[model samples]
Target: MIQLTVNGKPRKADVDPDTPLLWALRDSLLLTGTKYSCGSGLCGACTVHVDGQPVRSCITPVSAVAGKKVTTIEAVDGSRVGKAVQEAWRKLDVVQCGYCQSGQIMSAVGLLSKNRRPSDADIDAAMAGNLCRCATYVRIRAAIHEAAKALA
Candidate 1:
C-alpha cells in the first residue's frame, strides 16, 4: 500500500511500487485533471506538485511519493497563488484546444508560487518543458504577469 496526501487529504492506494504516480492518481484516485500527454515525461501534461515542487507524474513512481503531499490541478484553486493564476488564465482566455491548459496552469502556478514577480526569461525557463501545440505562449506569459500583479 502506498500512502500519501493528495489535495490535503490522506489517501492510500493498493498498487505496485513501480506504478507511475499518473496512473495512481487517474486510475486509483480518480484525479483525471492531470492529463497524460507524452507519457515519457518530456511534456509537462502530467505535471503535479509533490511537496509544492512541480513534478511530472508520468515518470514519478507512486512509492517515491509516500508520506509526501501531492497537489493536482483539481485543488489548485484552494490556494491564493493558484487561484490568481487560474483567474488570470480565465480572464485572458488562455485556453486554445484546452487539452494542455491543465498542465500549463499547473506549471504557471508552480512558477508563481516561488517567484512572485517572474521576468519573461524566468517564465520561459520555468515553462519551457510544457509544450502547447496551439502556440499560446504569448498569452500564457501575459497571464503569468497578470497573476503576479494580482498577487501583489
Candidate 2:
C-alpha cells in the first residue's frame, strides 16, 4: 500500500505504486474533479495542486506524491480564491459543455493565487495546456480577471 494526502485527508491505496494519481483520485478516492485528458501530460485537464503548486496529475504517479498534500478541484473550490473563481465563472457563464471546466477552474485558481493580477498573456501561459472543446476562452479569461479583482 502507498500512502498519500489528498485534500487534507490521509489515505492509502493498495494499487500499483506507479498508478497515475489521476486514476487513484478518481477510481480509488472518488474525487473526480481532476479530469483525465491527454494522459501524456500535454493536457492540463488533470491539474491539481501538490503542496500548493499546480501539477498535471495524469502523468504523475501516486508514489511521486508519497507525503505531499494533493488539492483537487473539489477541495480547492472552498477556498477564498477558489470561491472567487467559481463565483466568477458563474457570473460570466464561463462553462460550455462542462466537461473541461473543472480543470479550467483548477488551473485558473492556481494562476490567480500566485498573481492576483495577470495580463492576457499571463492567463494564456497559465492556461496553455487546458483545452476546452466548447471554446469558452473569452469567458474563461473574463472570469479569471474577475476572480483576480475579487481576490484583490
Candidate 3:
C-alpha cells in the first residue's frame, strides 16, 4: 500500500509503486478534478500540487508522493491565494470547454502564490505549460490580474 496525503486527508492505495499519481488520485482516491491530457507532460491537464508546488500528476509516480501532501483543485479552496484565484475564475467566467480549466486554475494558483502582482509576461511564462483549446487566454489573463488585485 502506498500512503499519501491528498486534499488534507490521509489516503492509502493498494497499487503498484510505479503507478502514476494521476491514476492513484482519480482511480483510488476518486479526486477526478485533475484531468488527463497528452499524458506525456506536454499538457498541463494533470497538474496538481505537491507540497504546494505545482507538479504534473500524470508523470509523477505514486510512490514519489508517499508521505507528502497532494493538493488537487478539489481542495484548492484551503488557501487564500487559491480562493482568490478560484473566485476570480468564477466571476470572470474563465472556463471555456471546462476540460482544461482545472489545470489552468492549478497553474494560476501556483503563479499567484509566488507573485501577488504578476504582469502579463509573468503570467505567460508561468502558464506556458497549460493550454486551453477554447482559447480563453484573454479572460484567463484578466482574471488572474483581477485575482491579484483582490488578493492585494
Q: Which parts of model 2 are misplaced by more than 4 Å?
A: none
Better of 2 and 3 by lDDT: 3
lDDT of 3 by residue, 80-120 (tens): 99999999999999887899889999999999999998999
lDDT score, candidate 2, position 56? 88
lDDT of 1 by residue, 36-86 (tens): 999998989999999999999999999999999999999999999999999
Question: By lDDT, who's the top model here?
Answer: 1
Superposed by TM-score, candidate 1 places the C-alpha of residue 18 at a distance from the truth, in angstroms, of 0.6
TM-score of each: 0.98, 0.96, 0.97
> Candidate 2: which pairs clash?
none
Error of 2 at 77 (Å): 1.8
Give a tens-digit lDDT track for model 2, residues 19-70. 9999999998898888887899886788899998888888999999999998
Model 3 ranges off by over 4 Å: none
What's the ranking of the predictions by lDDT, best on top?
A: 1, 3, 2
lDDT of 1 at 26: 96
TM-score of 1: 0.98
Window of ten residues with lowest summed lDDT in model 1: 98-107
Task: Report the number of the highest-TM-score candidate.
Answer: 1
